[model samples]
Target: MELQQMRYVVAVAETANFTRAAERCHVVQSALSHQIARLERELGARLFDRTSRRVHLTPAGEAFLPAARQALEAAERARAEVAAAAGEIRGRLAIGAIPTVSSVDLPRLLVNYRTRYPRVHISLRSAISEEMIEQVKEGTLDVAVLGLPPAGRVVGLRGHELARGGLVAIVAPGHRLADAGEVALAELADEEFVDFPTGTGARVQSDDAFEAAGVRREVAFEVNAIEFMTRFVRHGLGVGMVPTAFADELAGVRVLRITDATARVEVLVWSRSRPSPPAAALLELFDIDPESYS
Candidate 1:
């Protein structure tokens, strides 16, 4: 029932090897095994089904894992809260962002936050907007920078709009529409497109626009990365649409104004409850009131 025992179990479950779990917990294998055995005896349920080759969580372990993680996080947050009361901010800050985030200079912001709070641990990950938003809601991510269609809304979380702008069409220099200064969605409907995967927040703006305009376009290349989309357009694989701010960064492609394009909105979002102290500080840097979210 000790927190240390729970930690050992979690480590074992995550690494799936007693030896590696012991290494991660900074204990000898025998000691780690003995602790887990004692814990199992106390609970009267084996947590792991262990073999020489692999370790798998037992049904009981699977049930206990979530509570164990929550307990650990609660304990850590308790300590962080105490430190924050004493004017010291020390906690883990997990941040997520879309790959095409352009509203804020993320690297510079991270650098500034790090300089101001050297004791805080920080991690950043790149994901699609939908995934990042879900992580934020799940408490796995403290904050996120997300891009969605202008009409999209953030439910069950607090979000602040950072920037909004229309998408620009990109084409290869030799393409028929390359020289066109502006084109409508219907005009591009007959052209093949290179775009983000279907249903991604990045792709939805264009999708909604085309649908609203009653135009059906062919996505010849479904790419997960913006660079790849631009590359496909550059090589004449297909035309593509990107945020107006991001379009200038892509080389070897012609940027065209979309006369009837949907706008992309970049937003900063955090959990309405349980944002860590470091997350609060970062939000303060952006002049956002975290308490309002709560």
Candidate 2:
């Protein structure tokens, strides 16, 4: 019924302990319990099954939980919108980034943003591209810089390309493939490959290319970081693919072009819904006329 009751219910559902939920809500146990009891009585359904040991959400509670959280999020968003409209740019900006976007100039970008908006607090979190995209969709992350879909489209987001480059094959300096100027992806089908882990940006790009070419890669090493992939390839462990920008920097490896089918596009993605002021400002600063996808 009341927003406070909704908060209490959600807290109890998450912690699974009334005492802890009451503590989190910053109210006495009896008051929180009484309000929840009143809410259940009005709704005519038991939200939780209380045994002395552990609290469990009843079927009704499970059904109510998501909506309660949505309502809470909506209220918070409304408050942020009001503040932003009133020219208050002094709010926290939670940014998500992928560690391997070497050419993005993240340090410079953050520095400039901080210089321009000194009152705004900035927090950057490193995550795989896929995780960042999902968190942005969920409104947990204000914006993300990620290796994005080739066409630059996300279901619930508005984004634009930050940087675009083709992928290159890397091999040990003296390896057989090192001198090969450019090779087709199909040529590497029979070769042992070092690749990114599943659900990652590079992996997704590689997988789509392989599937489109009607071939499969024998991924002998599945590592998460591009640094590790290049290192392994340099040791003659396996051949690997990486963004062209970073391929030349690997000292022990010789870079070869993956002809036709290997490219990466880094996109700046944000929720399509009304974004907070700081997020909008960053997008405006980055989305230039030449490379804007949205």
Runs of candidate 2 exceeding 4 Å displacement: 1-79, 149-152, 211-216, 288-294
lDDT of 1 by residue, 1-294 (tens): 899999999999999999999999999999999999999999999999988899999999999998998898888799899999999999899999998888899999999999999999999999898998889887888999998888898899999999998889999999988888888888897899898888889889889999988999899889888898887888888999888898779999999998888778999999888578999999999999877664
Error of 2 at 156 (Å): 2.5
C-alpha lDDT (0 to 100) for residue 44 of candidate 1: 98
- Residues 154-261, model 2: lDDT tens digits: 677777667778888888887877889888888888889999888788788888877878887888999877888888988899988888888657888888887767
> Against the correct fold, how does model 1 do in TM-score?
0.93
